[model samples]
Target: MKLEMIGDIHLGMALNRKKADFDFNVKKRYPVISVSNIEEEGYFNNKGFEYFPSTELLSKKYFTEEGEVLMRLTHPNTAVYISKKQEDLLVPSYFVKIKITDKNYLPEYVAWYLNSEETKRELQKVQSGTRVTSTSKKVLETLVIKELSIEKQKRIVDLVELHQKEKTLYEKLIKEKEKQLAAATAEIMAD
Candidate 1:
């Protein structure tokens, strides 16, 4: 039996700009997500656009063990969106961690599927409400998940991780090359 899981449902809340020293309040948290830090490109359905720097920030508080489990479950490159409703309730936006129950599906494989463009479009459609577009647990449960054998799922996960590691190595090499070039330019100028 396969089960689709969705969590982190919350109402959108407006940021209170009038509060003195808003930055001070956010700095108190260990991990925080502010509207300003969220790039416009990543925002879906104008919600991210509507809110600016003054918008309320979301933070996730976790015990050490719970935090480790969450970091392990989610992909390192995946982005997590916070909801305003969760803020009002004093709940962390990352409170809900989703996982599929399919024995064949590896966690990484499922994460990649959810992060794909096609899945995002489907998610947008299921999101309801006018003032603030929100998704419920039911909506996530109905998502169409790919069916694959456990062996295949693990293989895919391994391949994706390998590619990611390669990309990181290449990025480091490029940065080193850039630094060398800069040094050469500076030496030429000095002479």
Candidate 2:
């Protein structure tokens, strides 16, 4: 077990979008992930997106890639893992792309940890601005990340995926029950 500041583990140190010349009026073929895509748990499961034009470089910049972690600047600082399938999608300026260079850490696990309650509280303390309440690149780089062996990180990620699946199932069950109850209530009036 080890603890390291986020700055020491990455090749790219909190690559945030700033002063980009992208034209918002132009629509691109792909959708860029927005803050709305993040759920209460900070999982990027929702398909929220905004159409934005993709520019060459956008300042010689990189797009989202597999094994990369993205953190939303807004409150809760939602962090998401970039799977192979999610690669090629444009990450908007509001997101700070964190690519972990350390082989000891897995991006999925790192993202999961960032979204954890402990990290959330830590980030809340460093938040800036009165209205938007966003996090800065400096704070992100200074954040502490608890390190575990690669095997343990993998196991933890697997367990989280299973838990997410369970939550989905429970939500479906509740919706089905609600439908059945509504139908039954309608029958009472017909009797």
Best by TM-score: 2
lDDT of 1 by residue, 73-188 (tens): 11111323333422322222322344334445555566556556786677677766676565555655566768678788778767766866786689799999999999999999
Clashing pairs in 2: 57-60
The residue ranges of model 2 lying beyond 4 angstroms of the native Cα positions read 1-29, 46-48, 54-62
Residue-wise lDDT of candidate 2 within 1-191, one digit each (tens)? 22234323222212233323556533334456766776766466657576544432443234677777888878867888888877766667567788777787888888898899998998899899998898877777778788888899999999998988899899899999999999999999789
TM-score of 2: 0.80
lDDT of each: 0.44, 0.71
After superposition, candidate 1 runs with Cα above 4 Å error:
1-91, 128-134
Which candidate tops lDDT?
2
Each prediction's Cα RMSD?
Answer: 9.0, 4.3
TM-score of each: 0.53, 0.80
TM-score of 1: 0.53
